[model samples]
Target: MQRSSTEGPSQYPHCLSSGRTQEAHLIRKGEDMENENKKSIKERVALRNSLVKEALAEFLGTFLLILFGVGSVAQTVLSRGSMGDPLTIHIGFTLAVTMAVYVAGGVSGAHINPAVSLAMCVLGRLSLCKFPVYAVCQFLGAFIGAAAVYGLYYDAFLDYTGGVLTVTGPNATAHIFSSYPGKHLSILNGFIDQVIGTGALLLCILAILDNKNKGAPKGIEPLMIGLIIMVIGVSMGLNCGYPVNPARDLGPRLFTAIAGWGTEVFSAGSHWWWIPVAGPLVGGMVGAVIYVLFIELHHVDPQKTPEEENSMKDKYEMIAMS
Candidate 1:
């Protein structure tokens, strides 16, 4: 007897046909979910890796910067015959900051100081969440760098300088390494000088970093930044010690104060202590704001033909796929 098609084999057997189809569909869905999860995990891993790399860059940059700065001061103390010269300190820090920024720019944007980081944050270039981490890393790196300088010149510091770290008389050059005036000046004058000097330095930094204006050649960004620091040091070295960078000033100052300088660290008084920190911070913010207002905000988006836009999209997709 001929059996009906549906009755003989159940047309699509529940277990072997429809059931298998359902199972295959379920498998496909599971695979899609897994792929999405893996993509998310990879993105998170990349982000974390980038952050770690950046933080390390900041630490190393700050370390090198302080090493050069404090090392110069140590040299002055160690050299019995050679007096501490302001010009030497100026040149030393100028070279240090320039080298550090150039070396670390690709990794961490070369923000070796908190003042710069804060300015970037204000300008929306840096995230607020990362500022504290960067600041702490920089401070610790500076402390370690100062220790290295101390070790390098321990004998000289003890014998030639008699372990004294004063900011006056023969050691007046130490102020250039750190921040102090040869003689006490009016607090207001000192504060104003710091503010104006720091402001000018930050302004120069902002100008150099303005990718829109193309103020300098691509490879010359670090050189320009360094030159700006050098000019500030030379022009304002005698006034307020030109601590255009708060971290650069405060970190080494703390080292000097704790290494045995005592309340003499505050010799300029509490009011003066705030000048370096406050001046640079305010100046950086103002500089970034001014840049955003006058330069960055007005950047012209390059006119692109349809082909160019499509080409860009294709390139982006290719990058994503890879």
Candidate 2:
């Protein structure tokens, strides 16, 4: 989400706003306050943002993200020594993430990845009720996106692999959907790689979004995030394909399992599926907490406004008079 500088104004209002009600609720001697203050179910629901709408935005955004990101891998792998190289894959994902942010940022903060959603929930920036909703929507979107790629590349896939779907070596395409550790890596190395990669991802995102830093260059935070991802891929991706997102890996991996890759999808690389899921969650929290400890928590609070001071005095005087 820009919280953008260049993008004029966001198309939708933020579900979370900073304003608070300032009215006084003076008690009467005989008022039945508890009953009177009780809200109807519909009223309470109306007071909050619609979970349906937020989830829908997340789905559409994540759909676009995986459609481009995973589809690029399919293109690269299926091309087989011709086009769609590693650099192209990086560019594809960078654009994919940027566009996804644009799609969902207005309504749902464009948290196309579950790690981002989990971080927001931990920071109390997003409602706990909506965290699971966002994560589920993202996973579903990724699944559908992978299914689309399979359908689009079916002929090319069979041609490239000679009708066999192998996880490694000649004619292998499993890496198009999920991640695997490098040949020299152990299970622990792969896990640490994921943790560090995802941790870096979150750190970049938090820094870009924090105004206390150099204040992002307007509407380009999304662009910045995408580039951050590309940088991570270029630098840290060799260890395990940098599947910093769980849905990005698991969704497509699950699809491959159903589409013919079978149990091999899960059995490969010491059951590596869980690392992208669990590692990002832990790494994202680590990044957020680091930002708080180093930057946010240390910043001094601004002094109260004169209007606030006057209001406080007036409220106290009114209490004494009563």
Among these predicted structures, which one has the highest lDDT?
A: 2
In model 1, pairs of residues that clash are none
TM-score versus the correct structure, for each prediction: 0.72, 0.77
| Model 1 lDDT-worst window of ten | 168-177
- List model 1 lDDT by residue over 195-269, tens digit each: 677678777888887766768888788878878877887787676667777777777777777877665666655
- Shift of residue 42 alpha carbon in model 1, Å: 18
What is the per-residue lDDT of model 2 for residues 1-322, given as tens digits with 9 covering 90 to 100?
A: 4455645434433422322121122334124465555545446655355778789889999888888998888888888747789899999999999999988888889988898889888899999888889999999998888988889899999899999999988788888888887888888887788778887888889888888677479899999989988999899888888888887888888888999988988888888778888888888878877877787777665688999999999999999999
lDDT of each: 0.76, 0.84
Clashing pairs in 2: 5-218, 6-218, 6-219
Q: What TM-score number comes out for model 1?
A: 0.72
Off by over 4 Å in 1: 1-48, 77-84, 164-177, 182-184, 267-271, 301-322
